[model samples]
Target chain A: MRNKEKTYNEIVQTAYVMFSEKGFDQTSLSSIASEIGISKPAIYYYFKSKDELIKYLFDKIVQEIQSLTSVELETITTTNFKQNLYQLGEAAISHQEKDVHFNHLFNQYMLLASRDTYYSERLLKIQQDFLNTFYDLLTYAVKINAIKDENILIKSQLLALVFDNITNFILTDMKLDYKKIWIEAVDSVLSGVEHHEQ
Target chain B: MRNKEKTYNEIVQTAYVMFSEKGFDQTSLSSIASEIGISKPAIYYYFKSKDELIKYLFDKIVQEIQSLTSVELETITTTNFKQNLYQLGEAAISHQEKDVHFNHLFNQYMLLASRDTYYSERLLKIQQDFLNTFYDLLTYAVKINAIKDENILIKSQLLALVFDNITNFILTDMKLDYKKIWIEAVDSVLSGVEHHEQ
Candidate 1:
């Protein structure tokens, strides 16, 4: 069992590198097996086909990203909402800084999403989860009488869009101070809610 | 001369259809020529290769999009700033509504941008132009005493990010009332500057 799992991991890792370099369509299972010194049949034992391999790889990538930067409700407080968001932005920046090829991988994934329902659903889930995090933060702020907003849904959705946009820029390797940009952008949106008494 | 121009246009239009349906990498000059009932060398006479064809196509796409939805400085008034923005958002929504394959072509172009400097520079120009439009709008608003903010640069950047994000969602075929969302999101960000006198 240990040997089987090791081979599976090696195949996945090799495939990731190849896909990132050559893109999903251009990379082949034969190429991955040759790169890993594994038999082609061995990969089939792990993943039925290239499609299955990509799906599995995508799920793993999303899980890694979620663990790295997703908001934790328990760590946030009503009064320090802006501070907590700043931390979220910082985590995002660090993730990008650590991985130079992440932007290419992400753009490739987005292209896949445009073609496949499975990828599009995954993309939507990420967007939905981001919006939900904002909804929870806003709810906590309202519960503590820290802010006022009649359109929480739209506000959270907008915040999620703004956050995703900035992150997209960071992922695309744009030469900008993303952390500063995120803070300034968040401040502009949050300021409207920050001072409202009712 | 007229026949030459007609054949050139046919090749471009046919390539556009094939590329939109099958993506850039999967589509080929031979396939495009066959589709248009022309010889492969005829396409070569107009475009040197697939790379050259794609570059030309991308340029045309950008030009078309710019003409469709880009903000016109002459159409704006300092007093009705938000209304002018709303009109801009409306033009964006209408553009998406008109073309279903635009999002896929855009995703393909973005994927190309990741691997090629030419595409990335084009993408940057679009983003920079968007940011500049916001700067112009905000400058006008401030000149007429319609809004006030010390961080116009950051504000314009954030607004551009938000606008681009919302348009991305629309292009990706997200089922939502985008115009309503655009208005609400813009309202939240703009409200911060609208009420501040200094």
Candidate 2:
């Protein structure tokens, strides 16, 4: 059982790198096994196929991300709401930066989500969770009079889109100051932009 | 020459629906050929393989979109810049609504672009073109004294992110009023948001 667990981790880690670099269709079970110095049967003992391997990776990543950044509802106050929310987005970006080739994994997942109903549903759940988090914060902001006149529901959804899309700049290899872009948009939307009619 | 052109269009149109519905990997050349009521060899006569067919489809779609929406810079001004820019975004959304299964097709392309240097480079050119359009309009806004901003380039890039992310809500089947969302963000950023500090 112990050895089997080690082998499982190896296969999944290898699949993550391969799938990130090569995509799902092009990456084969044989290549994964070869990279890990194991036979195809060894990978099969844990994951039945490439689809199964990817599914496992997806579920595990989701779980890890959720647990790592789960927030307590009772803890958020008006004063800290913006900071807390910003922290959450930062945590997500940092996790991607530190560990898994998260941007590539996410780009790969977008392809899968478009075709596979399973992935589509899985992604929706994660997005809904994030949207709700933004909604709750925006609701709190409205309560304290931080932002006004905006439909919180639509605003939340839009903010979620804005936040989620920040990571996409990485894929193009463009020399983008992503931090500035991310901060400017998120801050202005949440705290309300200081604007004037000239 | 005419028959060859007809055959090429037939293969591309058929591939479009299959690739959107079934994804690039699952949509085999045999499947596309059979669906088009043509033999496998006929598909090869126009294209080499599934990869070549997809590349051709991608290039064709990019060219079609570019030609369909090429903008004239001479007409934009301070007063009409916001509306003109808003119109550009609407054109993109409506084009997706009318012709291409754009959300699905774009999702598929993201996956392909992540791994394939060729597709990645191709997409960058398209994106750069779009980015330049946004930058140009924003620069015009600044010159005409419409938008007051510290960094036009970064603001333009961030605005592009905000606008581009709007289409993403479609993929989840969420009943979002995307046009409203798109316009609100663009307008606020372009025409300074009406702000009152308490």
Candidate 3:
């Protein structure tokens, strides 16, 4: 990485940690800068303000999620669609488990987004894109007679919502066998559709 | 109300507004007292600290939920089980809708619980209680041949989690017709069970 890019990443990384630990309202740019042993002015070069820094972090999070699921989401054969969904759940959990605090941070950012119109719109757009992906996949499943055509819109929304809630379950109860639980949960939702056909 | 009870209620009510508006971390007892036109010492006389006050608030929130769902939860006939669940979701949403900020405040409290062991246990117990209620209903459904007896535990857990997530969807997107969405979501999950039995 170039020197500027490296400095920019350092600032973002430090801010992410501080925001999660102390919370968005309590963590200031100066505190983040001091934590990195840098002057406030240096961070200002990379991020004009704390809000800008947070927006950048949100984009980075979106990019991480996209990269994680892009391969499975793009390759949607009828035979492998259920497997892809299961893999998506597994990938999300394994990635979050590796990071440990990512889900908590993501939720914290969500609360911030919920309060701010600009951030809310940004977050909602990404969520809608995801919902659209699931909707299209379900539409295809219906085409193949994999699922009944009933309530396709709501089922897709429910699946997307469940994906988020499963991540939240990990946050609330670390003892939960979330990967196993998530796979089973997805299986039931998908296979339940197959049962519906009969 | 009695004089002491009235004062206590005032303190709690003021704190709830301030906490939702400014967040838990940013809201102070002194500020709450000031907002209520009470002296700091008077506030201390009722609650020892902000932490104690927060615990009191948590209890109040739990009681509110219990009151809202107690009747539906207690009278769960096999025939009315799904109907009861639908009613519970409706009751929850309508109550939160009445308060406007209640869902946001609840989510804020959840974040606090996620970080603290004491609060996490308190929150988890209530979640477990709700899950058990749903689990029993599903087991009864299985016994009656209303549904298949597969994955009862996870289904109950998923149902409880979806309840939380549906409220969250309202938080993130107020434009959502959450009451309709929630009822339909529950119906599919329950009706999908019947499909499984077929």
Candidate 4:
């Protein structure tokens, strides 16, 4: 059973790389199987179709993100609010970049998912989960008086967008260092919004 | 002469629509001509090829944006920072929606352009123009004491990324109302970063 699960994961990872490089419509199951050095039947046994394969990959990504957030939140319990938020941002960006296939898969997934209703709901749930984490952080900061009280919804949404922009910038290979860029953005957000002692 | 120019403009507009609905690679000159009710030769008369058509369309977009920025900068001499910045963000989002084809062309262009050196220079120039405009705005704001004097390069880059996100969100048909969302984002940047007098 463990061996079967490992093979399934390996196939998904290989499929993600091909899908990102060639696009969904362009990638073929045979090519994926060939790349993985696995038989077509083996892939079919794991995933009924290419669409199902992509969906499974998406689910795994969401699960990984959920786990990452939970772990980070648990570790940051004693840290200052600003440091905690910065760490979260760094972790999210780092995780996305650590695997080249991750950003490509994410961009492709988002572009397709946005247009299709069936996929959009699933995508929205993933987005909401991520946003809820940020919202909780903001709410905590406000409670701790580390940040000013404003509209939490708008604030959370804005922070989410900022992070989105950072991710896109990195994925696009923009001629800027993302680490420096994101760190500065976090500082700007923290300093700009925090209640300053007059 | 005026009639010929109008006809050419109509052809370009029709091509933009078709290209946006059907992606650039998926679109052909024959189809664009058919949509415009013109012969294939007629399209060649206006644009020698599909690449030429894309270049023409991109140049027109850059020109339109440059003109808009110039007009806005000229009119707002007093530097009412927040209002000016808000209006600029509003203009950008509205312009994007009005020229929906620009977004489609841009997305396809990014994928294709990234692989070809021929398109890279033109793409880079467009990006540079955008960055310069944003930097100018940030500089003006800082000079007028509307925003804190900090690293304009990083802030400008972040602002440009936000603008790109707004355009992407609109193109993706995301559920959030862009105008309201942009207003909130701009307000957050302004309010968070400004030196508040207690």
lDDT of 3 by residue, A74-190 (tens): 467667777777787787777877885676677777777756777778778777777777788788878876667877777777777777777777766745666666666566556
lDDT of 3 by residue, B129-194 (tens): 766767777787787666778777777777777777777777666466666666666665655566
lDDT at B106, model 4? 67
Clash-forming residue pairs, model 3: none
lDDT of each: 0.76, 0.73, 0.73, 0.70
Candidate 2 clashing pairs? none
Model 2, position B168, has a per-residue lDDT of: 63
Worst 10 residues of 1 chain B by lDDT: B68-77
- Give the residue spans of candidate 4 off by over 4 A: A1-10, A30-48, A68-79, A192-198, B1-15, B18-78, B99-101, B119-121, B141-148, B171-198
Candidate with best TM-score:
2
Cα lDDT tens digits for candidate 4, B130-185: 77888888787777666777777777777777776777777655566666666666
| Candidate 1 DockQ vs. native | 0.54
- Model 3 TM-score, all chains together: 0.83
Instruction: Flag regions of model 2 displaced more than 4 Å.
Output: A68-70, A191-198, B65-70, B191-198
lDDT of 1 by residue, A1-198 (tens): 999888988998888877876788878788888888887888999888888998888888888766754666665666677788788778777876777566567667777776678888888787566667878877776666667766766776777777777767775556666777788766756676675446
Which residue pairs of candidate 1 clash?
A: none
Candidate 3 Cα lDDT to native: 0.73
Tens digits of per-residue lDDT for model 2, A1-198: 898889888888899989888777888889988999999888878877767788888887788656854677567765676677677667766665676476677666766776688988888787777778778777766676555746678767666776677666655666677777666666656544322336
As a whole number from 0 to 100, the lDDT of residue B56 in candidate 4 is 79
Best by lDDT: 1
lDDT of 4 by residue, A1-198 (tens): 998998888898888788777777667888888888888888989888878998888887777667876524434442366677777678878877787566666666665563566666776777777668778877777776777777666666666777777766665565676666666666655655577767
Cα lDDT of model 2 by residue, B87-126, tens digit: 8778767766675466677667866777678888888888
